[model samples]
Target: MNGTATHRTVIIVGSGPTGLLLAGDLATAGVPVTLLEKRSHDISNLSRAFGVHARTLEQLDARGLADQLLATGDTITGLRAFDRLTLDLTTLESRFPFMLITPQYEVERLLERRAREAGVDFAYESEVVGLRQDADGVELEVRGADGTVAVRRAAYVVGADGHHSAVRREIGLDFPGVSVIKSLFLADVRLAERPEDVLTVNGAGDCFAMIASFGDGWYRVMGWDRHHEVADDVPIDLDEVKDVARRALGSDYGMHDARWLSRFHSDERQAPRYRVGRVFLAGDAAHIHSPAGGQGMNTGLQDAANLSWKLAAAVQGWAPDGLLDTYETERHPVGKAVLRSSGGLVRLARAQSPALRAVRALVSAVGNTVGPARRKALGQISGIGYRYPALRGAHRLTGTRVPDVALAGGRLHEALRGGRFVLITPDPQAYEDPGTRKDRLTVECWASGRRTTVLVRPDGYVAWAADAPDATAIEEAVAAAVG
Candidate 1:
């Protein structure tokens, strides 16, 4: 170890939503966090992502951030696919049941603010070029904009940089996947006529287009003409963007005053492993996928949420054996599933062959008519369907996310604002004194008629639950979960 190297408890690379949220969470938990970013601190107005799902809203709500975000975005209670299947989120079980249509920069702005408020050390314009990890800590070689280089050390390091991550490369992790969609064009422009739908998306045989207002005067248009497989750097003509929109949606809503235009491709890739020794990867550094369902940024935020508490536990010296490993075990499956579903959506949208078109029609019909199919599809897309694997002999509720149920003190999510485990039981006496484990657990009586004891994790998942419980079981479960 270098004697003069700057050291922190945790160093997070990339100041995007994932790294910002992770740094905020760690800092909020009283863990010292340093955030490194290659870009300056200036916020950009252009964005590729526009939709935030319900589960992500729930996560933001847990941190008392949902209201601010909701204020900045418009809500769409229903989403249509294939111009036939309508996934209704209005009846979904969440405080924010609809998808929020806002610019990706808005989300990043909120996270960055939270991170700053939490006192995260920001090292902007500093790019991580190399990484080395030993049994105790990880060291990073960072190059500043002025060509100055420095070596920094941290007990743990996380890579939340995008798909072309230097940290992942330095660790020799393989991002094994292929490009799923190519030559997609994106444009942000002023719209003279606003669409009735909050989000309008449709795909024809060889063309696709999606339009969503930023709740500002500007609208984001994303589309692609399958016939044009141009390079990303090629300048995109406004007429081409409008032509694709007209082909897919029948009109461009008088799109004009182009603010931004670009061409890019989407890839479906996942790192072989999320962690290597003391270094870890999250967000785009760990996984990337098509932008079909707007899952990219939301999945990254959830990844940060899943990892932050565990990393905090590890830093605080209370994480049980294998707790840190569970981050990969739980989140890797979710990443794979996102890639599958998002890729499926892209394929469905691009279906042109007679057989594939027929299959797509059948799926749309079934999804529209079948209650379970619609519910499942909406749940998965909105991130409510995800569940971690339960441990042996664990409760049925274990691994499932805890809904924002009404509680005696406040909403279930409100109770989690402090970032502590909440134990709700019909019989509170079953658990030992909360005063003893106040730092790790909070005991509360059930709000209403529920004869079960449920232990909710910091990230809003049910860690353990039982219809009938005793002090011994509660103690053991707590010890097993948080040590």
Candidate 2:
């Protein structure tokens, strides 16, 4: 039951969205990447996620996938949270100001296609049974669909497997967290009557529920019953979903013809470390939280975006010292923040007592009326407000997300398509010979004629920015960042 060992520059232990993106980025950057997945070929998870947020859309746009994915779904500009607060995404500064309501499988299909085009070597039905990492490389014992065991060695391995990650288990990392909700029901059903809103959710009585379009005739519905607690193994019927929807969402919308149904629990957990030696974790393998904010998949995609370039740099031998460590440092805090925010949304939806309900209403009042509070909430939910930790004496813009601004050639996102560090300046001649890595850097001028010159990372965060372009400083910034 054993086969010979094989080697790859980087091995990814899952083919989910996160793993696919990371593998694609690495492969596109001319690094050898192999992806291992336990699932069979052509299998889809029935699309657990429906709403792709604005920030994630921007990430997709950078890879030339946003428009194609947008065609497969509908869009919503405002998101209703806990029934009272509506976060308006139309005011967001990115090119994508609204969330796309599509099945998760659409995203997977697109990402997988891109990954394939980028030359990612994929081994389907190859499950990671065990993982061990040393100083030089990581070793993975994989089991194929035929039950034959093989060993895969890689300079680095990323586990984007999921909440029940074999890589995390093999590595002995603690995923300490509590179950935020139990007996949660999710289903895809045909709704004879369409809801007024693109996304419908409510926290009424003992039920918390949400329903959104899958862009076809079916609607994706999710509900949790506070009074009727049951184990996940118990089968859920359409009538049960109808009852919950009636109570929580006010009406079932004449929902019929259940295509798929399941019951599960949501856990709020984050790994203490995203990286251990040469092994890394992304997506659900690193964090999981309530789906209240529609951030489960979005956050995972962002994690891949943040980690992929750093990984590419490391494998290509140009990454600055300790650049790999920033993956955990930058993302762990975001994961923790997501857990808190999504957990808070779940708790607010589950509030049963009069005092808690009043507090919820007060929060709603403030969030709806207060400008700063609303913007902050929108920022958190949309994933646009987050900024990485800035270096000492760095410019205020450093680590902040660079909005999709127009360049002399095209949009900023277009310039980032090849995963190169972008240096935007008013005077290109100032840094004509800045001694930066020419292959890894793309120089562009602002179409709006701005004076400041900014170095943007491949993942679309500001690495360094200067009010006025200085050749020495620009050279130093490029050398320090895009080495």
Prediction-by-prediction clash tally: 0, 0
Candidate 1: residue pairs that collide: none
For model 1, the local distance difference test gives 0.89
> Across residues 92-144, which tens digit of lDDT does each residue of candidate 1 receive?
98888899999989998999899889988899899998888887888899999
Least accurate 10 contiguous residues by lDDT in model 1 = 1-10
**TM-score of candidate 1 relative to the true fold:** 0.97
lDDT of 2 by residue, 137-233 (tens): 8888999988988888888889899999998888899999999887788999999899988788787767778898887887899988888888989
The regions of model 1 sitting more than 4 angstroms off are: 1-8, 434-436
Cα deviation of 434 in candidate 1 (Å)?
5.9
Clashing pairs in 2: none
